[model samples]
Target: MTRKLHTLSTVTALFAGLATAHGLPATAEAAPTGQTVAAQDVSPSMLSAMQRDLGLSEEQIHRRLAFEATAARVELRLSQELGSTFGGAWLNEDGSQLIVGVTDEASAALVRLAGAEPRRVARSKAQLDRVMDELDRNAANASASSIHTWYVDLPTNSVVVTAADSVMSKFQAENFIARTSGAKDGTIRVVRSAEAPRPLYDTRGGDAYYPGNARCSIGFAVNGGFVTAGHCGGVGTTTSGHNRVAQGTVRGSSFPGNDYGWVQTNGSWASQPWVNNYAGGNDVVSGSSEAGIGASICRSGSTTGKRCGAIQAKNVTVNYSNGPVYGLTQTNVCAEGGDSGGSWLSGNQAQGVTSGGSGNCTSGGTTFFQPLNPILSVYGLSLTTNGGGGGGKGFVSRLNGKCIDVPNSNFSDGVQLQMWDCNGTNAQKFTWVGSTLQIGGKCVDVANASTANGTPIQLVSCNGNRAQDFVLSGAGDLVSYLANKCVDIKDVSSASGAKLHLWDCNGAANQKWDYR
Candidate 1:
């Protein structure tokens, strides 16, 4: 059978990404001693979400959850036993073998004895940490954009600095790291990147918090209030909720060194552990359990709602045009302006706050976030959910995380539906209500309730009519209950203007729906 080709970098294809983290450190702190996941305890919703986003079977999801748990324990043991030599650890692409990073033959031997595979590298975690810290210090007084970011690349076992190919002073990045304690004689590589990251900020409106004139998303609700990106505002800055009503005040804020902030809300608003799913539901947060490298992750933002992806790397230092922000976790999830301070959740556990990233949801991109544990520890704040948060959005591609957009925001009655780009706009939003895929409380109806192939789907006032009912098939097809016909992308085109209509289910990509 011919397989559908997809951009593996997308939220829908996060698990399919080929380049796993070969070099990196913990994105969040290690699981508390003796803490490990047991697949039996994994939530059904979380498992279902993994199935939807990663294209894994229920059995695969269950098995991988156990593997992730074991991987976490093995990583912790290697981290403790190997000490500075422990570069990183991740499950191989198939999620079967655990690959550990070691800087010496001795450490590799130790890892092999622990029942894992070990890859050798040049710089130890200690050496890489020192290099990043030095770069951070040097970057403090420098300009932004010259170098987008720098981080320990455990794959190559060095510190990788990112900048556009057009950057004339790319050498400055390498030279800066060279000044680190052992970088001159150690490993530090410079690579060209596509876009420079900036703190997601906007002056417009949406589901966001306001600090004076600046607008940003709420990361996650905590005990006293919520957490967000420090770049949104500074300490003592007053804020307003999405309602524009008096919201809260920034009790503490930090940037450059670390991009994080917390807002203590007023009595008008209280915390809720539930995060609103843009697709149409609320996810219950369970705990702040740390996921291992290469694990699946999702985010929630006021601008994008929710999106999914996998954890790419950790201990990263990002260089925004403003300056360098240290200790960030990276992912391939796309994020846009105004998405900062959003929620990044991994299997119901709050991950981090959206920091900065390059790219839009349309074309795809990379993003970073301030991990939740550090933020929680720093402020002594409690996540509203049973789990914890760093708070960000994938701005993912799930039905709940993404939108089944109308082409170009045009909402004509007969306009053909398209899976364009997802943004927190009314035109792009979709809600599954009762048995219907709804928009603005209108049902996604079949043209005349016809069973004929190629009949268009449109919006109409919802009734109990069976013609408005649909089912998402196991193969990801949105099949109408009216005719057992599948909602398909007309002509199988993935372009922005592709029209959608009912067709026979054939397990095609255009017919597949990922509603996380």
Candidate 2:
């Protein structure tokens, strides 16, 4: 028997549909129901898994992906255009249509014109967010052991307060809601739930590494390592692979308030941009674009392999036996112990890392995950996509201690490079992907592919050319592969805004670089 992986044929097809409808006019209309934008580029195994879990046929999956691609763009535009009046947006159960909520008729018309079905609601998303914030501020001291979770439900345009089934729990939930500052504004609704959420961790699994004596699955590979649930280990904790080989160390971690962590792997291990589908192949991770609520999602774990489901809610707060973890996305997927830190995907887009949930796979369950974007932001990490390298994202500082800056984050072709004081911004962040220095989806290239003594270094589109290949040699030199030349600061200036150029490799302090 072979294991199925989350692999795809080509990663580009996963998000190609998004580009079809980038901008919409005020009089635009939604895509017709059951109509696909183009041919679906999904694998047979993935299609089968989704069909079994979401109860949709191969044709339905294709249609849903196309509609969702357009809806994603519409949602982004309306959210920005209708700021305060925008309530929320979500897809129907089958994902054939997108429904947007608005507090005013004008916004409703805009939503309709933007290709999404618009519904009227009392409170806007901003108002509900404020109420949810208030609830979170008070939750630390609230007497609420029976509360399952609370989140902003897009369809209802209100904050949902899920309480346990006991009468005492209901009374406590009611009191908690009543005491909240904005709960009386009809922004809060209470629902009863019998399930309890907890962190999933076990001591046994095949595709998991040992953090201490506990096993957890790998989330997604970053530049220099992989991410997992923070509860698996603390800072400086060592990990071993499933085969008991020395793997990596926990360089960063955060739990309770937020469950996330990253492991800096040793040179013996190499990070890959694929997730195990456990059926037969690997699913290549192309990007981390977040999927909207009600979209089909799948999770890969050591214990359960791959499980498919739909996203139920976002910005959810789950109370566990240890403490409350906030900002989790709720789902209907089932996961078991040893599945913590596993990867979740919305189509080919990376969703998050599994945190915890309630129930089991045998009789259905509700799970939650820590969204991936925040994890990357917090750790200053860049995702390792297909054919990409892993070395993390940060300032590439030189001998003068200044960073290689992108000059206002402008990615225009032929924009010359400069060295400036590092302020920890995206302009100064660079990642190594297959020996090429990347920033803002562009590559640091040698101008005109010249081998002259003073050829200027510039930013250009990534074309896999020799002009774009660079590596940090063991001697601390930033060497360009074009002609084995070194990137040096012009005039050997230690001042800010010093321009960078290529020169013959020499053991000089001016040509030395460090990624920090």
Candidate 3:
């Protein structure tokens, strides 16, 4: 997979645009585009696309264009002198300096000769040297029963060496510290071999049965349900509340490659927009927008409950012990096994679900999560509360008392309803007042908005818009704008096309729909 370099200027512009659209303060500093030059020197289309997508002001665009030109010149000189063996080059996080990585001392010297600053130390190389020196020094003291393992903790910028009880073990630790005295802070803790537990979820706790227990926070609530991380549970899995009271059932789930799911519940469990009740206070769920690396984020889970960290990288692919999952964002937050499906948020906005990570809060580690936007779009689910619950009105029923004509038009249990533009027709004339959209007197709804498109629209006790929005046509079956299809049950029967198709309405029983 190709890794795209994230441009700081683009990120700034995106934030500015979002701020402007949402009436928030524009907190981003404007970036320099590049040096002025001939039109032939730049890719006009690429420049235009950046400006549009990134929402760059003209001055910012021009400045960045100039910066790019100068950087290109610098790149050419460095490449020619250092040859193809040079490692890589990237702009610093501030976009003010260029960092070029060279393979060895020779390449580093060449780069410096080319008028570029070259730092002598490579952390990885320095680490390897320290390790080898320690091993060689301790070889004479090595005993038959010794085990050693080395690992890097990027968050703390430290290297850890785990070893079994032996003379070599003590020697290795002392020698490593002595050789790399200048490399890191001189703080090392020797943990006993048996005390170092492997990092994986131990699903042995009774509290693990709740959604919060699994670390998955609520995204959005639909008519009769809410959506969350699929890895938390599978279809038909029973769920309980933090207090261990029966809450809901996993209506649908998908994991490994895709991480998303939805749950349907009775009225006893009311959905809220609140996330973690940190010792300070309960964190709110605001809205969802993709945040850039270096942006601050907070998470709420059952185990490590609530914590804040910065986003380290986006679109990272992680191979967990369970399986390979793609498009996860890495962070410095600490999470344990039960926290797998927990909520990851930027400020009050929804970000993603905690997938997995190495390390713990005590020692520090890297955690990864699946982004929420794609999951919402794919499954056609909305995040319930922006910051997690309190700010907005609770769930409303999409169908209540309106009008009904066709007998089976009231969807049977276990199907989803879509919204279509209302046309004054009896099928579309439902009054959505409170939590439920009422037609005549009954409530119309979907069993659940599972990704399966053919899920039917049904009538039930009013919940809210989670199942309400509907599109109407003067001469055909009512369509759902949410699902982008017409109201149709699983084909009168559950066969292949028996799954409803949103054909041009011919005013049939399958097409007519009434909220009540």
Best prediction by TM-score: 2
For all candidates in order, the CA lDDT equals 0.65, 0.75, 0.46
Cα TM-score of candidate 3? 0.41
Those runs of model 1 whose alpha carbons end farther than 4 Å from true positions after fitting are: 1-53, 181-183, 202-207, 387-516
- The true-structure Cα RMSD of candidate 3 reads 17.6
Candidate 2 regions with alpha-carbon error over 4 angstroms: 1-41, 203-206, 391-516
Q: TM-scores of all models?
A: 0.63, 0.72, 0.41
Best by lDDT: 2
User: What is the per-residue lDDT of model 3 for residues 279-299, given as tens digits with 9 covering 90 to 100?
Assistant: 444454544545544444566
Order of the predicted models by lDDT, top scorer first: 2, 1, 3
Please give the distance, in angstroms, between residue 379's alpha carbon in candidate 1 and its true position after superposition.
1.2
**Lowest-scoring 10 consecutive residues by lDDT in candidate 3?**
1-10
Query: Tens digit of lDDT per residue, candidate 2, span 1-516?
Result: 011011111111112223343221222234455523442345566677888888887766765665565556456545655778888888888776778889888777666555567899988898888888888887865444688788999887778988898988988888888877666677789898778888888522115788877777788888778888888899999999878899999999999889999999999887787777777787767556678888888888877777899899999988776777899999999988777888887766677899998888999889899998788767867787553454234545556888888888898999999988877777776755444677776789999999888999999987867788665543456776555578998988888888999998776777888655
